[model samples]
Target: MPTIRLKTTINAPQERVFNLSRSLDLHIASAAKTKEKVISVKQTGLLELNEEVTWRAKHLGVYQNLTSKITQFNFPHSFTDEMQKGAFKSFSHQHLFEKISEEKTQLIDVFEYESPMGILGKLADKLFLKSYMKRFLLERNQVIKTTAESENYKKYIST
Candidate 1:
């Protein structure tokens, strides 16, 4: 599996930042472009352990549907999700939140994915997905940072 890790320090507390991370709505709103691609996503079950979310999106020039269930959720700290379908041999994303200070928090996104083919997979990864994934993570992080700093979210949350 090829792992991509992006760590960012956000100007917010661990709890507030963690809540924002759990808000799928905030995530979609932050990433302006990807918001358009996604048709809809909803959490029908309890959002704790093993909760499932149906994600519908158009990517790679096609309509891609993926179901992800919460594998782990430690409130105001961390969570993990495993992909049920739609591209990649295995996809698991871990989100970590750490209180660096009374107001500052560190947000880390660790993504691990494996391509299907053997040798060709490596080539595709190096040529395409790896860099693209890095950029994607960075952009999403930027959105998160902005949203976290916004007045609406910044009000009750310490940052």
Candidate 2:
């Protein structure tokens, strides 16, 4: 399996940025090309370790439903989600946030996904999936970064 890690810095407070970064609704909103559904959310212990969420979304014009459980969480610093079921052979996305200044946070996203169909998968990964997938994730993150830094987003999160 191949892992690609990307990092970006966003100008926002730790608490504010973390809250927005971890929001499922906000994530969906940032992706104009894709739609998502939340199958469930634990009313209590949200943003806490062990919290689980079930959701489905469209990517590359394909719908993939998944149940992901929060494997790790520390109030806002870092967290990980492991997919229970999805289109990929395996999937996981880990988000890390570090306060660099009073109004800035370093955001790191790490992802691991496996393609199906062995030989075809190998071919796709090498031939096309690699660069294309990286761009897809980075563009999504850019959207998140842009939205999170907006004045409206700040006001909404503050309220």
Candidate 3:
């Protein structure tokens, strides 16, 4: 499995950052370039622990559908989601939020994924998939950071 660790500092509260990270609306907006959409029934809005969601999107010019489940959750501190079905052999993404101050929060993402095709997958990972996934996560986190720091976050979270 290949691991990707990233940290993003947002000028917002930890609660805001955490909520935005799990917001269905925000995710759809952030992945607008890929046209990612939630296709699972009875799964929308803020995702909770043990909840599963299926997403359909276009990646690498190929259309794919992936199903994931929230395996762990701990309020505004941390959460973990793992792939149940997808192109990859397996994947797990952990979201961690640290409160730096009343107005600052650091969002950390730890992503690990394994590709199929054995040796061919390893070569692809080494050659391009690793960097590609990193770029994808960075873009997603940028959207989270920007949205969490702005007043627009209110549209995703409720009081």
Candidate 4:
């Protein structure tokens, strides 16, 4: 498995950042370039513990569907979501938020994923997927960071 870790500092409250990170609407909006959308569920709001969402998107010129469930949740601090079904062998993402000050928060993303094939998978991960996945997470986190720092986050989370 390859893990991609990212840290983002946002000028916002921990609770606000945490909620925006889990917002279904925000995630879809962030991935607008990929045309990603939730396919299995119509519910579009903040996600909670044990909640599952199935998303369909175009990546690498192919359409893929991935379903993931929130396995662990510690409100305003951290949350973990694991893949239930997807292209990869397995995948999990952990979102953590630390309050740096009254108006600043440090957001951390820990993403771990494994491809299906044996040696081929390893090669793909080493040669291509690693950087691709990292970029994807970085883009997503950038959305979260920007939203958290702006008034747009108000639509995602209530203060």
Highest lDDT model number: 3
Model 3 alpha-carbon drift over 4 Å, by segment: none
lDDT of 2 by residue, 1-159 (tens): 868799989887777667776666666666556677676754222355676777677866788777777787876688888877776687788888989998898888898888888989878889887777788778877866787778766533653
Residues 4-67 of candidate 1 have per-residue lDDT tens digits of 9989999976777787776666555654554433333453212567866666655555666767
Whole-model Cα lDDT per candidate? 0.74, 0.74, 0.93, 0.91
> For every candidate structure, what is the RMSD over all alpha carbons to the true structure, in angstroms?
3.2, 2.7, 0.9, 0.9
What are the per-residue Cα lDDT tens digits for candidate 3 across 6-60? 9999999998899899988889999998999999984457999999999999999
Looking at model 1, residue 112 earns an lDDT score of: 95
| Candidate 4 global lDDT | 0.91
- Count of clashes in candidate 2: 0
Task: Judge candidate 3 at residue 46 and give its lDDT.
Answer: 92
Assess every candidate by TM-score. 0.84, 0.83, 0.97, 0.97
Flag the better candidate by TM-score, 1 or 2. Answer: 1
Worst 10 residues of 3 by lDDT: 39-48
Stretch of 10 with least lDDT, candidate 1? 37-46
The CA root-mean-square deviation of candidate 4, after full C-alpha superposition on the true structure, stands at: 0.9
lDDT of 1: 0.74
Q: Please identify which of the two predictions, 2 or 3, would achieve the higher lDDT against the true structure.
A: 3
Q: Ranking under lDDT, best-scoring first?
A: 3, 4, 1, 2
Backbone clashes in candidate 1 total 0
